[model samples]
Target: MRKHKIAVVPGDGVGPEVIAAGLEVLQAVAAADGGFAVESESFDWGSDRYRRLGRMMPEDGVETLRGFDAIYFGAVGDPEIPDHITLWELRLAICQGLDQYANVRPTRLLPGMQGPLRPELGEQIDWVIVRENSEGEYAGVGGRVHAGLPLETGIDVAVFTREGVARICRFACELARSRPRKRLTVVTKSNAQRHGMVFWDAVCREVLADFPDLDVDFKLVDAMAARMVTHPGDIDTVVATNLHADVLSDLASALTGSLGNGATANINPNAGVPSMFEPIHGSAFDITGKGIANPVGAFWTGAMMLEHLGEDAAAERLMKAVERVTENGPRTPDMGGQAGSADVTKAVLAAL
Candidate 1:
């Protein structure tokens, strides 16, 4: 049997709760399949660890995680720690360290779920957001010179390179080609941001040449937002910068049904290193101990992890089970039901 080593980092708040539910589903699937095995190592790294060690993780955390086949990451935020510090310290550190450049978020309206959009829209709003993960606005390029003074000014430079832009656009195009529509929408603000944004448009155009059959178009970031809501069916694959895609994908998730159903994969398509899979809904602090935190996102993330690990049948089976449960009944409160995390997880396993 093929055994895959997985590093589990249940970050904070509802992270551990939802991750536990996901693992249960994963275990159930593996037991039923009998084709492969998953050996996971859980790491106590997050806000609590930061409070004790003055850092989110040990200095060698990245080195330790490098050996895993994939990283199954839960949400990473706490009330005590600053958001930027927590994000940069753990999540960003791992992504940059591993060179996982493409952040892929797939949004679709699951069965029996009512999205903010009209119920008639249904699954027509399906979209895959290809975010330029490694660089762009999130790059820690600038700093503050003067602190706590009227003259203090901070600069956060947006880094855009030809290689970065081209590779991401190519990835999006290939993804678009794989879909039925073969359509791609490139998001940029070139008219305003001359240097970085304009360069992004140029690189995307250069990359489009390689895929002659693709039906590609460009839109300003602001206009793209309206189009996503107004005409989601017109878009199949979307490519954008880090910050733009981050915000857009959240909007995409909300339109599908709930943020609790969104999952993301930080992939290094070349397979040179391990990729990271996570639920983008974040740690819902208000529902941390309420046992009402949704586990659909984490379950979907686990399916993505299995897919990345070359377990295609297992991944598809897990997702079909989730859809079956969602279509039937007994959903979490986020999906307008009275079920708790464990209840939904049990329903999914039973469906499996």
Candidate 2:
């Protein structure tokens, strides 16, 4: 049997709850499928760790996670802490340090979850948003206030590099080719951020030329947002920059239902750095211990991790089970049901 070592970081807020449920689902799948198993090592690494140690993960944190086959991450965010501090300290640290530069966030409507698409458009809404993870507007090239007291100004430079843009676009194109529809939509704001976005569009054009068979198109960020609401079926795949993709993907997920149904994978396939997979939603601290937080995002993210580990069959099975449970209409409070996260998790497990 092949054993895969997975680094598990159950992050903060309801992250641990969802992680527990997701691990349970993964275990169930392993029991049902032979010849493969997962060994997960829990890591106490997040905001709380930062508060105590006065830093995010240890300096050796990236190296510590290097040996794992993959990392199963729960959401990371706490109202009590400064968002950027924790984000850069942990999430962004692992990403840039480990060279996990391509973030693939998939937005698909679950069975009972409603979408902006009409009934005639399609039954299942599946789309992937490929984000340039390392550098873009998120590159952190800016200055804060107090530097010029008279001006009292702050500056944020939206940086974009050819290497970063080209790699992520190529990844998106490759992914599009494998999907049912060979289509890729490049989203940008060349109309506004001329230099940076124009560079991104040029990179997309260059990459699209390599994949001649794929149908490629570009949309301004604003139009893309509107179309996503009114014409989602028109899009099959989307690739965008860090900040733009971040906003659009969250909007896409919300269009399908709540933001809790999306999962993302931060990958650096060449480095052997274990990819980090997690739900796209933030930590819902309000529902922290209420048991009302949705675990669909976590479980679905686990499925993505399964596929990344080369267990596509198990991943598909888990997804089908999720679809079944949702179709049966046993939804969590966010989805307009009384069932808690545990109830939905068990229903999914039973279906599996």
Among the numbered candidates, top lDDT falls to 1
TM-score, candidate 2, is: 0.96
* Off by more than 4 A, model 1: none
**Candidate 1 residue lDDT tens string, 163-207:** 999999998999999999999999999999999999999999999
Q: List runs of model 2 lying over 4 Å from the truth.
A: 116-124, 145-148
Q: Compared with the true structure, what per-residue lDDT tens digits does model 2 show for residues 1-352? A: 8888999988888888889899999989887887689899998888889889888678898899999999998878888789998799888988888889888988777777775567554354578888889988899899888775887888889878888888889899999999989999999889988798888898889888999989988999999988887777889889988888889888878877777778889999785679999988787888989998888898889899999989999999999998898889578887878999889988988998
lDDT of 1: 0.92
Please state every model's RMSD to the true fold in angstroms.
0.9, 1.6
252: Cα error in model 1, Å:
0.6
TM-scores vs. true structure, each candidate: 0.98, 0.96
| Clash count list over all predictions | 0, 0
Top-scoring candidate (TM-score): 1
